[model samples]
Target chain A: MRVLGVDPGLTRCGVGVVEGVPGRPCTLVAYYVVYTDPADELPLRLLHLDTELTRLVAEHRPESVAVERVFSQHNVRTVMGTAQASAVAVLAGARAGLPVQTYTPSEVKAAITGSGQADKAQMMAMVTRLLRLAEPPRPADAADALALAICHIWRGGTRARIAAAADAVRQRTAASRTGARPGAPGRPGPKRQGGTR
Target chain B: MRVLGVDPGLTRCGVGVVEGVPGRPCTLVAYYVVYTDPADELPLRLLHLDTELTRLVAEHRPESVAVERVFSQHNVRTVMGTAQASAVAVLAGARAGLPVQTYTPSEVKAAITGSGQADKAQMMAMVTRLLRLAEPPRPADAADALALAICHIWRGGTRARIAAAADAVRQRTAASRTGARPGAPGRPGPKRQGGTR
Candidate 1:
């Protein structure tokens, strides 16, 4: 399966596409860092990320999208920009009907280097070795994009299965809460209601 | 001026529109809370927010958009969701070509109630008083949204002018860096380059 990975940032959004399946070596298809000028307004920067990401999704047609989940950072401004950029990527993936999963930095590192504490150089070296590129990708962001893709390619399928199972459980629980039969096969489940604020 | 205010949340996004110039009493046009199920996937939740906000902007045709700038919260999950939801609102504003600004909660409070630390009750009371509503808007989120709009109506124009001046300074600095004439009228400035990963 092909996966699109996004390392989101306001000024520089890293995007990479990889083709692979579980237990197979992944091949890099395309890599890009979409940039927006810091001088630009927040809305314009967000729009730039959104338009570029949407274009990438349309061009690559990846089966799934992987985004780096934003965590609290000491620099609140940086984290906020990352989160905003990630939201744009997620929106693009949804528009393209691609399943999107978010992987934490540690998760991506562990999946790639077998250690959550792997340093940037180690991860970059591993990515270069894994993709068998003659030279490492430039601008660290590009390497991160590859790592994110590799991590998702290796772990995302299992994660998705687990999520689907959990969804089933949630549906069943919600059904029971609404007085429906618990686990009755072929029961006409009620339609999911839209949230009303 | 017409302003669209967005109080963004993952489960319930509050939106309100008001029409008036600065220093004039603003009139409420419409308010609604867009909702998305928590059980839905993150991508879907973001998509729902994007679509709803875009529709609201189209329907209201606001002259400007205002979003509550997310701050660091103790609840990481809640903060992340809020950040994501706010991104969608910002994107919608950019797409509509409307000037967008973000107001902090305290700033909104200060603008509406003359106190940065005003309680919700005070803010809501002021919203009702200013909008000349018979009763406070329901679901707290709706009231907060009106407060956001009112805040923008009172404070956003000056902020926009300041931001525009900043943009000009940044442009001049960038041009100087590139050896172009500073503020040369109609100078053929280089196009902003996209990020390279």
Candidate 2:
């Protein structure tokens, strides 16, 4: 599955695209950091971010998108910008009919580095090793974006499997009640459920 | 000038449009509370807001837009939504090429009422009295939106006057230096220095 991950911010929004499934090495497709001028009016800055994100989505056409879920624990002024930028990213994915997911910083860290409390250096080291890059992605935001993409691929794969398993169980139960073969395909259920994280 | 004021929220976004100058009694053009299902995904909710605001701007063709500036001191979760929604509203106005301004809650209250510490009921009462509405706009959100519009008009008028005065002084200074008559409109300067609040 091709996935796009966004580490959203008004000043520096990082975007990374990766292709892979769960339990497999993910391939890095591309990475970018979108920048907006702080001196610009808020609306124009947001508009610029929106335009870039929409263009990126059009270019990459990822099957799904993942964004870092912003929390209010951060510096109040910065968090608002982060939330606004994330909104644009989420809207870009949803407008394109792609499933969009958001993971907390801790969740992304735990998924990439095996610990939610891992520091930035540790996470960067893991992201470098996992993606088999020549060097660590420069400008922390880029690495964070890649990490979010990796986390989503792994977690989304597990969620998909669990959903499929639950669907199988339900199908089997329904078949037994109808006195039909358990292996037989009765009807197709929802393809996927609960895309948000 | 026609102004659209937005009290942005994920579930209930209030929009109000009015037409008038700074000191004159404003005339209400229209008012609405755009609703999005709270159960909807965050991206979907933002998309709904963007779509509605875009349509409103297109239909009304307002000269400018005003949105309430979201602060972080409010309920954390609710504040995030407010920031996101305000971002969408700002984007809509910017995309339509309208000047967009944001005012803090206190600023709006102070502009509408005599004091910034005024409560909602007092602000609504002023809004009703100022607009000469038959009744106070329904829902606190609606009244708040109208207040924002009114605030923008009054404050924007003051800002414009200040800008014009500054421009006039600069022109007179330049005229004296260049041996040209003052107020001759020599080499027309840029109009409207700033659009943001």
Candidate 3:
């Protein structure tokens, strides 16, 4: 499975992608950032973000999108800008029909480093270490984005899904021995396809 | 020059890229809609978007990124989503080291149809006609992203800059004959340089 991770920011949005199944190490595919001038009017800034995001989505074609959830910040303007940039991300994912998932900063950090309070540099190092990347992903934002996606795959149960799917098949065989057909009206809850997901 | 326009949204983000010099109607290098599941948490969603955007930017290598400016909408939730998505875009461009530009929805509409209030369908039609695409861009949102890029290129003064630069050269020639040097302490006002913006 392929996952795209984003770190939302109005002035600078970070993006990263990793492709792989869970339990196994994730493959680092790409990472980058988008920058806009806050000095510009809000609408224009959003528009610029939208256009670039759209282009990027079309080009990458990921199966799913992952983004950072905004926690409240002290600055009103900063929060507002962050919120607006995040919208552009959701918009991009939806427009492309890619399943989008978001994780809070703490969650991503915890999943990657076994700690939720990891600082930006710590998160980056963990991302590089966890993914076994060639280097610490340049531009901390991009690494954060990568960490977020890897964290989602880590959380989303890629490995468990596979195991569960196999167990589901095994259960179906056992049911078939007793003459129950798959999806046969009330036949023990449809055997949970796609694995306990 | 290829310019990518993006319309950032949490539900649907639009992407379109026009490849050509200013004044020359651009070709739609690519277009698509990105979608994310509504139930996902915001951070995971952002991560997903970031990953996808990085790949796209790397693939397209657009010289300039054009995106829509966010607007104040009545619904707070809706506005919040839009804002978040927009931030992802800003981050994407910055990471790529590409110059990013923004336009208002009204600015895009006005450029395409001579009206700031042009509807989506109208903008799509005009964009298709202007860009000379094989067909109207899909998902309406993608068309919007494309239109935003076109609008910026049309009015971005890229071509105008070329002309302005030529005129500056002419003025400098004339001034030199009369002994006026730009960027140097002069008999009149402060001298200007023709080189660098």
Give the number of the best model, judged by lDDT. Answer: 2
Candidate 3: list runs displaced more than 4 Å: A1-79, A82-197, B162-170, B173-197
TM-score of 1: 0.78
**Residue B74 miss distance in model 1 (angstroms):** 5.9
Ranking by lDDT: 2, 1, 3
Q: Which number leads on DockQ?
A: 2
For all candidates, what are the clash counts?
2, 0, 99
Cα lDDT for residue B47, model 1? Answer: 88
Tens digit of lDDT per residue, candidate 3, span A25-108? 788888889998878855567667777877877887888888888755425547777777777777678668777777888899
**Per-residue lDDT of model 2, residues A113-148, tens digit only:** 889999999999999988999999988998999999
TM-score of each: 0.78, 0.87, 0.52
**Candidate 1 structure lDDT:** 0.86
Docking class of 1: medium
Ranking by TM-score: 2, 1, 3
Predicted candidate 2 versus true structure: per-residue lDDT over B25-124, tens digit per residue: 8999999999999998887888889889999999999999999999888898788988889989999998898889999999998888869899978998
TM-score winner, 1 or 3: 1
Clashing pairs in 2: none
